[model samples]
Each structure stands twice: as structure tokens, then as C-alpha cells.
Target: MARRQVNPRDLDLVIAAVHAVDPCPADQEAAWTDRVRERAVSLYVLGDTVGQDIARLDAAKQFTATLLDVRVEASSTRGVLVLRNTSGSSSSSSGPTAAIPRPGGR
Candidate 1:
């Protein structure tokens, strides 16, 4: 009976991820980035149903962060975005966005 709004932090997190993965080559236009961003958000939103862990919006501010930090920063490294926790517990979120290290130190 109501339309559920997606989280803004969810968006911020996804966009950061898109920038890291696609980085928009010089040849690409705004449309390309838009598409990429849209796709990223869609995927992230669908994470729970897609069988992935969900992170807290406030905990992850950087392109990558552990489950206590929430600050954004520029990053090219691929990683998972995890929710920040005051302390580690077996009951992890609904988490995780992180910058996975490049293979062979690429």
C-alpha cells in the first residue's frame, strides 16, 4: 500500500562502487555513467534477494570500510562494503561493501 524509498546511503555506496569498477573511460559519455550507476544501485538493492549480505548505510562511507567506520573517500581498488559495527558479533547485518585487492597487485 506504500512505496518504499531506497536509502540514500545505499545509493552513495553503489555509486562509489561503480566509479571503482567502471571508472568511465575518456571515450564514454554521461549516459554511460548513468547506466552504470543505475545498474550498480539496482544490484546493490537486490543484494538480499540475490543471496548476499546487506550492510548498514551509515557504517560505510568510504568505497570500502569495515563493519565501525563511515566516511567516504576515493578508491580504485575493488572491495566489499561492510557495515560498521561498534563491535564484532556473530550476528552481522543485513553488510558489506569492500574494495577487494587487485589480483597480482594489479
Candidate 2:
């Protein structure tokens, strides 16, 4: 496959554009791909951020919006997507998040 480019507002497109591989290799029908279908309210927090992992999981059950602007650092305006290491430490943190404006502008 060739390189692909996308914007935050158009991230939902990846759900359909993803290909199949591994244990649940169903391409667009994969379970992993299904989770992020509603990118606007997807919950993804730092895996090494103590209770945040479980908190994020619980919030997912109710379709809440968290991890909206996980930054690279305290002073950064950019966002990040974090991953865990073999020992449950923060291995990497990159990428951005997608979320539509909240209702009532709150």
C-alpha cells in the first residue's frame, strides 16, 4: 500500500479504508476498527497514567468524550496518542485525536 494522508476531521474515513490482518483479519469488519467508528467521542488515554486506563475503559461503556487533547507535554498545543511498553510504561506518544464540538458549546 502507498502512503495516505488525512485530516483530523476526516479520521472516520480510516474505519472503512483499513485492511485486514492478524487474528481478527476482517479488514473493515475487524473488531479493532469497530471501536474507533465514532471518532468524535473515542476514549484513548495514556496507558501508563495510573487509574486513567481503567477510567478510560469505563467511560467507553457510556460513550463519553475524554482524551480530547492529550498533549505531548504541559506546554504543547499539539495532541498525542500513547502506547504502552512491555513493562506497562509509556513507550511512545504521538498522533492526534478527533472530536466534534460538544453540544451546547460547553
Give the best candidate by lDDT: 1
Per-residue lDDT of candidate 2, residues 1-106 (tens digit): 9988777645544443333223344564556555544332332222236467668767763422333234344344443544444455553345334223333443
Report the C-alpha displacement of residue 74, candidate 2, in angstroms. 8.5
Among these predictions, the greatest TM-score belongs to: 1
Report, for all candidates in order, the number of backbone clashes.
Answer: 23, 0
Model 2, CA-based lDDT: 0.43
TM-score of 1: 0.28
Candidate 2 off by > 4 Å: 1-69, 72-77, 96-106
lDDT of 1 at 31: 67
Residue 63 shift from truth in candidate 1, angstroms: 39
**Model 2 residue 103 CA deviation in Å:** 12
